[model samples]
Target: MPRAIGPVLVEGPVEVVLPDGTVVVSERPVVALCLCRRSRRYPFCDTSHRRRSRPSVERPADGEQA
Candidate 1:
């Protein structure tokens, strides 16, 4: 089985080349892909998190119930 790759710190999206010369694209470090590209989520901060705000509710989308 292939190992899970990374918490790879990068300034932008990176091309991950495998040992076999196959390349995989890691998720864009940006938060909102089309937005201003500044977000609370680091590496790429789209600033969308700044817009999607209700300070009274901190639970993320997964329903883990923060």
Candidate 2:
């Protein structure tokens, strides 16, 4: 199922078959699969989705003024 702030959840131990036929196995009681594709650990959630992108802060050039 989808979560409001995280990856989709599924019961384990699960054997996930990738598009390329690569199989991934997890022995945990529960698994969190990444849907946003932002996780460094593909097919598994590493809590990367919880991290918000930081906006660039524009500072005054050469500190002329704030």
Candidate 3:
């Protein structure tokens, strides 16, 4: 039998029946809907939660003061 796990979290290849009597299918092993509203793919996880790199620090010259 098929069922929904949570509001946004669902198992793979879940079949969603729209209000218009249309059916939508997901073919992934696991479907993670975007809650933060930052995912480019929307309603799917594209690994966009990774942190960004920091700016590089500048070092002093050989004869620079302590």
Candidate 4:
């Protein structure tokens, strides 16, 4: 059997196969995968959201929010 190493965080449905041909999946809306094996929570973003620092979008008076 091959060793599998990963902590992939998934926002949608996903499928994985182990070296022994073991399949893994989640029946939920969100999933987290581990990367460095340092995550105590393992996989899920522990407030590690990347900030773009994008300026606030300005909208025209006649324009509707998309």
Per TM-score, the best of the predicted structures is: 2
Shift in Å, residue 32, candidate 2: 0.4
Question: Clash pairs of candidate 2?
Answer: none
lDDT ranking of the models: 2, 3, 4, 1
**lDDT, model 2, position 60:** 92
lDDT of each: 0.45, 0.90, 0.63, 0.55
- In angstroms, give how far residue 14 of model 1 lies from its true place: 1.1
Give all candidate RMSDs, comma-separated. Answer: 13.3, 3.8, 8.4, 12.3
Residue 55 in model 4: shift from native, Å? 41
lDDT of 1 by residue, 1-66 (tens): 664222324544665555588775646663223224344433333445346445685557785655
Query: Which pairs clash (backbone N, Cα, C closer than 3 Å) in model 4?
Result: 7-33, 7-34, 8-33, 9-33, 33-43
Among the numbered candidates, top lDDT falls to 2
As for model 2, its CA RMSD to the true structure in angstroms is: 3.8
lDDT of 4 by residue, 1-66 (tens): 654344455776756565688776766677765544455543433433332378997776675655
- Per-residue lDDT, model 3, residue 58, is 75
Q: Report the C-alpha lDDT of model 3 over 1-66, residue by residue, as the tens digit.
A: 564332366788876665588776789877776555456765564556553477887778899964
Candidate 2, overall lDDT? Answer: 0.90
TM-score of 4: 0.36
Clashes of each: 6, 0, 0, 5
Clashing pairs in 1: 38-45, 38-46, 38-47, 39-45, 39-46, 39-47
| Stretches of model 3 off by over 4 angstroms after superposition | 1-9, 15-24, 53-56
Q: TM-score for every candidate vs. truth?
A: 0.29, 0.71, 0.46, 0.36
The lDDT of model 4 is 0.55
* Model 3 TM-score (2 dp): 0.46
